[model samples]
Target chain A: MTEDKFKHEEDLFCSGHRACPGCGAALTSKLVTEATGPQTILSMPTGCMEVTTTPYPESAWGISWIHNIFENSAAVAGGIETAYRSFDKRNKEGYMNHEDVNFVVLAGDGATFDIGIRSLSGMMERGHDVLYICYDNEAYMNTGIQRSSSTPIGAATTTSPAGKESFGEDVHKKDMPSIAAAHGLEYVATASVAYPEDFKKKVEKALEIEGPKYIQIFAPCPRGWRHESKNSIEIARLVVETGLYPIFEMENGKITNVKKLKDRKPVEEYLKVQGRFKHLFEKEGGEEVLEELQKIADSNAEKIGIDKE
Target chain B: MTEDPYEDLKISKGAVVKPRTTLVNKTGSWRSEKPIIDHEKCIACGNCEKFCPDMAVKETEEGKFEIDLEYCKGCGICAEECPVKAIIMEEEEK
Candidate 1:
């Protein structure tokens, strides 16, 4: 994927409101809009990206956008696509038929995984021509860094605080790609802000597919995860290498391709860097948790078909 | 479905919440009903309780869970993550 293909003259997620410095969600939105172009209509849900970009009256989004409650973004996007198509079908001269106009839904992990899964599943099952992009910063950063269904096990969130007898967010993140693919949707993929070119390519691929498309983006939340803003890309890269978040895609219900990986690191490398996981190492029995995390990573590498080097 | 070998699988304190279908929770008056659950099945899994953006689900006694209908936006995580499928969401016309 070339950089030019993902570059745009107009910024969809502008440089104003309040996203933490070097916010990965911000970067993902920018790249998505650039790839999808300005004519896109964004169906946003309540989350960090939504809160940060649209602070009441002011908004950083440059495209036609609508902020719906957290769970119904997919439903709203589906309806918008239906409306757009119906309008275009009635009028021959209507500008709505332009290929640049993408009916896209931008949602967070909480919205996508736990809350919106039903509608999201419904949208895919219905085979609507919409793109659902989940910018996963792990925890629900908008609501004070609480745990979300997407919060990986052993990671600390407000709701899943590290305590003597507790393991943080015990369940694994719902595998969105697999779930969406199971619906026999045209496309489902994973991307990260660290790889803008790859991320843009995945968006483009989703557009080419006739039915619904889902892209779960691994966005870094520094404040919530207690990391420096500058290390967003670095940490994102580590996430992939560690197998915590593998970059891959599924077409229909079959695995088509997996991204290249060379230097595989222990999950502890990724965990040790974040303060959220600090307790897992600093606490008396934290090392055991780190070992458990390693097992999780190794298993994901195997399941996703990421060849060990 | 096969178990996700990656999960830590910590069972929270209390009776395991039984998973229910959408049909079970249907109340005629519900504009939307958020499932308040039994924490025993919860394992403090943080599945349903975690993603609730409205802060609806609260851990009461050691292993108990309750849903605050007042703040709930009607996003159904409690129903979705009930490992036992204990909770179900019902939307009734208001």
Candidate 2:
């Protein structure tokens, strides 16, 4: 039922950037910017994005972009929307008559879930007309793959390095969409770069809504995940097929629909694909870890109503 | 009859806050490590204390923030919020 109504254009993200090969965050950024078109104001935080795209005098962003402190992106974006309104009122009749630009916040998982959560939560609660998208590459990939609250259990990061006495991240990935939905917001959805049509459509839908909207985008981090660039889409597909990252949307705190894969892939197939989970398979009795992960995935699927075909 | 939405806020009703005990330390127990202030790199910006969920970090002599491990969740919010990246989450081996 997937329609190709998407017209892949070239206005926002210019090619030949310094992002690592097969970086999902980069691809998602490109797609998101394109969806919003050139009339967009981006509030980016200090992470892999701010580092890779902008190097001192030169910048990569074509839109009017502001790089705020790591944890204050939502607050900054909210401020930008207000400022735009005031400017348009005094000069061009209130952000309505002129080119209707989208005010968007782009943040990593570290910023969205860990450091900048309060600002994001507050902005969303206040009903700011901004699209808050989280380009989740799992951990804090910008600072060498340190473990953030978004990192899944058994995943290795610089801080949660697998040692003789440790099992990498000890906690499960925090349910961010559920937390966002609990705010009684208009929209909350999950998308991945692997599925561009769905992702683009979701972005479009989010823009059409009046109130605050949130999208937790699953972007693959090749450097942090230790995977080849070509395997990005395949690995992302496995994440959905294994039921780890169920693609679904929540409206008014209730899930309406979920994307179900016809073929259910084993959790091992997903596990062995990423190097971050390499520790889970590199040891004896690794099957136990795999089973535990599968159980978690199954539970998630049940919660989201993702039935196996 | 219209009801107030937050009148039934469960979290603010003096509910007992419990630690994550059911999370079995399959990776062995985490050592209670706290943030040590270098003072040299500390900017006294209060970002660490401002963003700390547990409020375990506090500023002491010379305006440097020190971590109180008792309530610290090892969440590393301080490290992430530190503008200069001064705070590092060091693991204390049990």
Best by TM-score: 1
lDDT of 1: 0.73
lDDT of every predicted structure (CA atoms): 0.73, 0.74
Alpha-carbon DockQ of candidate 1 = 0.01
- Lowest summed lDDT over 10 consecutive residues: which window, candidate 1 chain A? A1-10
**Model 1, range A1-309, lDDT digits (tens) per residue?**
123221211335444435664467866877787788778888988988887666655566667778888889999999988887777878756566835478899999999998899899998889788999999998788889988888888888889988888767777776777888888877789987767788999998888767799999999887899986546677887898888888988877777888867767888888888888889877887777788888888888788878646
Q: DockQ of all candidates, in order?
A: 0.01, 0.01
Model 2 ranges with Cα > 4 A deviation: A1-10, A87-99, B1-94
- On residues A214-280, what C-alpha lDDT tens digit does candidate 2 reach at each position? 9998888877988765466667778988888999988888888789866667798988978888888
Reference-based lDDT, residue A179, model 1: 82
Docking class of 2: incorrect
TM-scores, each model vs. reference: 0.73, 0.72
